[model samples]
Target: MTDGLEGARERRVRTGEGVELCVAELGDPAHPTVVLLHGYPDSKEVWAPVARRLRDRFHVVLYDVRGCGRSSAPKPLRGGFTLEKLTDDFLTVLDAVSPDAPVHLVGHDWGSVQGWEFVTVRRTEGRIASFTSMSGPSLDHFGHWIKKRLARPTPRRIAQLLGQGAKSWYVYALHTPVLPELAWKGPLGKSWPRILRKLEKVPAGAYPTPSLPTDAAHGAWLYRDNIRSRLRRPRDDCYAHAPVQLITPTEDAFLSEQLYDELELWAPQLTRHTLPAKHWVPRTRPDQLAVWISEFATASEPDAAGVPAQLAAPRTGRYAERFGGQLVLVTGAASGIGRATAFAFAEAGARIVVVDRDAEGAARTAEMARLVGAPDAWPETVDVGDGQAMEKLAARTAAEHGVVDVLVNNAGTGVTGDFMDTSVEDWQRTLDVNLWGVIHGCRTFGRQMAERGQGGHIVNTASAIAFQPTRALPAYATSKAAVLMLSECLRAELAGQGIGVSAICPGVVNTNITATTRFVGTDEEEEKRHQDRTTRLYGLRNYPPEKVADAVLRAVIRNEAVVPVTPEAHGARLLSRLSPRVVRALARVRPRV
Candidate 1:
């Protein structure tokens, strides 16, 4: 057993076929039961991370499938691991654990394969309240998918069939005689942990267990007994009796996302969630998985009439397909571009986290985000320049709201003056908020994203002035230039990890930044006049902050390195690349004020 499940209560569940299964329970027995089933070649300990997360909220149950872990293998290994026998094992465990109440079923890989069976069969109808599947497909549904494509013979469908066939190479190998059994019990089982770490980026830990050799050898039978029979003659009435949540790992090596194209035909009330991770999400992305499972299971409860109603309504936002159920955090979200970006993500059904130095303003933005369509929204007050405070905020956000899927480092201040005239204090303050702020946000939150091994996006709000030289605003331009470079460097470093870094450059947007902009080397009266003049000029330009917000979303979707938001920003970028002399000439011109 893993350390996380140390205190779990143990029970022995005996199936009628003389198979003994090991079951473990955590949390209150009276609470709603959530049964977690492990995939092939994995013991119940594979769910230690997820089980620990869910134990506080619900009664969590985990059991090794027969022949996998502490469970006893059937007398004969040949036809022992069929789906019918697995179903019998499931019923026996369910009867022993929560005989009175139905359970919320959660599964990964082969476990998900079995879950599809349990949810669709008539005998297990009222015993299961909801089913959440990840990295697995029902053999029956897959059979139908293959039959339809072969019948149609479309080019696209044929290509999809070929692609999935290539991915299923291991399946064929697994069914080939005693060689698979020999490999698993020998060098293959010994090196499996290292393979997972290198390929899937699964952290090194006390998982896979010492029983892996025996487990894997026995598990090859799972494919041999079921794969051929089900795919040849799939059941027509294999429709789900309960609400189903399908969590697809976009980077899964074994399955194609296209396998579920016709899933809605089988499951009427299906909710889909896509994660940028690999196949073993139970260990790699347990935090996110726990959150999703909790939300889905809660919504499936009999008392959660409002939850299902809210989910049933289709989202109309353009980015809903990409961002729905994602968590987005925006700094300086009280007003201007930050606020607009928060609202835009909210409209796509993403959970919102509004961060700003202004507490009330952040709270207001969060409130508006919830009203707009966010499933959940929260406000966090912290100065991005304060490293310690940002660290605490990042920790709190992760612990409270889960890791941020999208981070927008938008908080910044404005400083305008010639290089010689700008005070040291002016430069320091400007760089602290504009450049160091981006650094702090990326360092704190980006680390969590990287550690989680799930892909995420980071957007740093630079300025058009970064590429387009400005004579008057020395301090602001320098700070923004640093931000642009930082974003570029970070992008290259994180590209391999699937974390995208985008620098958003916007030319003059009509916002409150100008009203508060500092004009150094000027008297109070002169500074006030300069502020007003700049603010008025920006207002006359009439560029909406919402456009910049839209660009932020587009940048994340495209994984763009640098985005020029407005017409002037685009022109300036083009000039910087194509005609440096013209850009220099434009920069030499004095401000109107």
Candidate 2:
């Protein structure tokens, strides 16, 4: 065995056909094994990112399939790359690495296609403990999907078939005689990395290896040898014998989400996760994939009782399909809209980070978030207006919880007074919390999102007063207006980086801000009276903060630039744009003291 990446032990496993397969292993031999299989036109190097992540917790292994990378190709190239031969190669590796123990399996693209064959076959049962598949579907299930659709072709079914057929255009190209090999040996192989970077947003690095031309030329047999025969006579008894986890990239160019609509029929124990990403998740989303793989593999381990391992139950939440397993950070999550937003994302199965100046309140919110359905939740205490404190928080969050997938900057203070009555201190305080707080969040967390190169979203809580002017609320309105403009500018700047920025404008909702609001140019007794009166009026309006929370999720999902929450907010926004004079006239009416 030779030493490779991170002191990985490298060896060779020979198949019965005398083909040498290159295998690399990391971590302790005594630990549970996790075997990672690469896909078409790629080598074991494609799994380097994911393997590095799993090595600490499990025995991670990666191998190049025959005819790719350092693996030796079979003698007769035409009938060399059949699925049965691939299965034999997998079995040989498993027996050589861990003969006494079952191994957890992970596959991407064509590797996933091969894994479907492994876990479903009776001869391979009990040797495989669990399977995690991505970016590929089972040929048998696909065959059944097509047969059912053709047997009774509804309009929706026809559309799905046509859509998938269009996506499979490359399959036809690969099936051509000698053309694919020529293309791979010529210009196509040299430009493959550049094409992946431009089209799929795969990060540029030392991947696809120097032998890509030979690898791809030989990989064409993967499609030509299996697809036609399997689809025509797919096995009827193809059911998985182990717990299965399926991670689907929602934006994969080669596969449609509809392809797995009836997957439950084949796999009785199934857990599904969706990622808002394109193809090549191993390169772009290795962190998230590693986390999920570790969780599934750990759950599949048998207990001391020697009973069969029980898989985790699937997450059944409203937005689980969109945000499950993602990290979300909500600032000012101690009360009002911020706390409600945290709870909403938690209910969607996202991990939550609650940040607020009130340490106890933040901790309480984090605890409640776990009960609601968050996989995990943590609390961080810091005043959003404190730039240094926010910078520390951002660094700690990235280091501990990974890069935040969604950020909600909902911290603000209420100020009500005439321009002259509002002192300079009051103006500075409001701007510090309302305007500068949002700036701190976007600058700190948004920079991390940009650096990570994966897409994310930022939500800033502006107010209806941003566009609708009022004489009694000058300082508060100005601060909120700046937030709205900042969100717009950031949205335009970050569009190219795949980051989304949204300004949530709410009119009036019953919350605690009114009671804490400052009244300028008033005695202590008079200020107390004004606070009670304003709180009463807002309570009578009776708008719930939960509604605003719902709008925040919608804005992130749709990547909306500006969203008006309340009905009055919508009307006010329209009036401000369509009839400015009418809006100004309405704003002239002052609130009663």
Candidate 3:
């Protein structure tokens, strides 16, 4: 017999890494666990009410993610606060508390970013079943979004500059050892409440100022080591693949909502949710949060080994499950692997938005997406090769769906020809779809998510050809390689902004691509001859597109930027790394069909 109220209080515990974290335990310990991570300017106390609600059904856990609240914030910072370090912090807590068992994970603001990254990098989705994210974007898309949006006229520029300056105040201070200490001890401490109050859309009469110290220093370390460093170290490869739940507070004062455009490219296995509260939804609507957490912690799913151990896993055993309510937008989604990936995401529980140049094909795919259990699937016909059209599509999709929590830039074209045979138009079209399409998605939706200050995810489709280019198809190879590089660069650049970027690469997939692509030739006989030559020269075997979709889901959860979809592709990649010349020679010795 228990009152279930004892769980709401904060406690201190040691993590696997020997770091002592100030943890708040809510709900009965006997029930399944749910770990809650707090963001900057806050503590575990904010989750008290929410924890209480879940006490009877869930063993809810809340902790300050290494710094802030009662967690140990070592002088000069312990382990530094890069996303990898931050992810380790979460893992430490989980491993120490839950051991090898899985738990439900929930995060808000910076917490959400860390949560997603933790599950991906640690491959802890096996131990941590689901994620409920509030306000975070994929780092890759976020950087592209910020760059494009900030490049606008004077007013927007001024606002961005001011916003970055204001938000970066603590960031600048943390660069030096002396100022962080001074600020923590003096004026910065005194103004903490006022600053936090200004950042929220809370009514004046809602709650008293939290009786917590204004230690912005601990939080600033995250920005410096994780955010800023990632930006400076653009082109680093880091991506995550995991199932996530994203919650957006409609009335958030600090983070805007519009930046979530084309977020589906980032997390195909994402669920979109909303709360009609202020920035402090955990504090304001704690009970609702608790209910959601409880539901997520108790749900179950099958664990399949559909994904590689380095990527994602297929549904197999029963595990805790989270609700699904995400809207995913996929560009170049109508045919080939894009359509199959869209259908796969839908089957995993997502509202799908199928886009392509062919309206009828897109509609048919949308119908399939819906059949796979998407709450609502939409189809839009647009030329991904056109920048203006992509912008319009992004805007329209956001307006229609409210938020694109997941975005997959799976639309691309492969124009295979001898470098000498390929014209400028061939190169432009290939670049337009393969590189520029992804760029457009990041700019349109990523900016909106960034302005909103919530983090999101973006997935750009490249090809194995990007990693190990063949002598032929120079234009196609260059375009895909560029996409891969772009995804890597964005991953580093947008770490602080909370956006994650993953570059998806698949081997040859069986589809109508040979027929649909604009392959220039004289007559029908000549085109057939070209096709036969390509088949004979490459010895290409088409894998199913659904397999690529499975790979995409895995990549998202694991936060891997470079995802090779096939065993052959992986082998080729390894060969390229070990001996480029040997790999090239092997590729040259293709068997004739």
TM-score leader: 1
Alpha-carbon runs more than 4 Å astray in model 3: 1-323, 518-523, 529-542, 586-593
Give the per-residue lDDT digits (tens) of candidate 3, residues 1-593: 11222525666766555667766676666566788776765566555556656667777787766666667765457446677666667767777567745777888877776776665653565676677777654444456456656567477655765664564464466677667756766786777556555564222332322334444656666666666545544322334455666677766655655556556656666555665456787655553465455544444322354232232332221111221444568877778778877877777656678889889989999998877666568899888878888788877875555446567888887676566777888888888888898888888877755554445678898888876766566788798889989899988987676677898877776666665454453456776776666544334565677788878877766668788878777877788899988867854543331
Compute each candidate's TM-score over C-alphas.
Answer: 0.93, 0.89, 0.50
Compute the lDDT of residue 161 as modeled in candidate 3: 51
1-593: candidate 1 lDDT, tens digit per residue: 44447779998888898999999999999888999999978899999988888899899999999898889999898899888889999999999998977899999999999999999999898888899999989999999999999999989999999999999999999989999999999999999999988888777877878999999999899999999999999999999988999999889999999999979999998988887779998988786688678878877875534223233545679897678778899999999999999999999878899999999999999999999988789999999999999999999998876788999999989988788998888889998899999999999999998987777999999999998898988889989999999999999999988999999999999999998899887999999999999889999999999999999999999999999988988988999999999988988887867
Which is superior by lDDT, 1 or 3?
Answer: 1
Global CA lDDT of candidate 3, please? 0.66
Per residue, candidate 2 scores C-alpha lDDT tens digits across 1-593 of 32225577889999999999999999988888999999988888888777877888899989999999999999889989998999999999999998878899999999999999999998898889899999988999999999999999999999999999999999999999999999999999889999988777776766878888999999999999999999888999999999899999988999999999979889988999999888798887876788788888999976666455878676777778788878899998999999999999999888899999889999999999999988779999999999999999999987666789999999899999889999999999999999999999999999988877778999999999988999889999999999999999999999998999999999899989998899998988999999999889999999999999999999999999999989888988998999999988977878777
Off by over 4 Å in 2: 1-7, 27-31, 151-158, 381-383, 386-402, 447-454, 492-499, 514-516, 522-542, 574-579, 586-590
Worst 10 residues of 3 by lDDT: 314-323
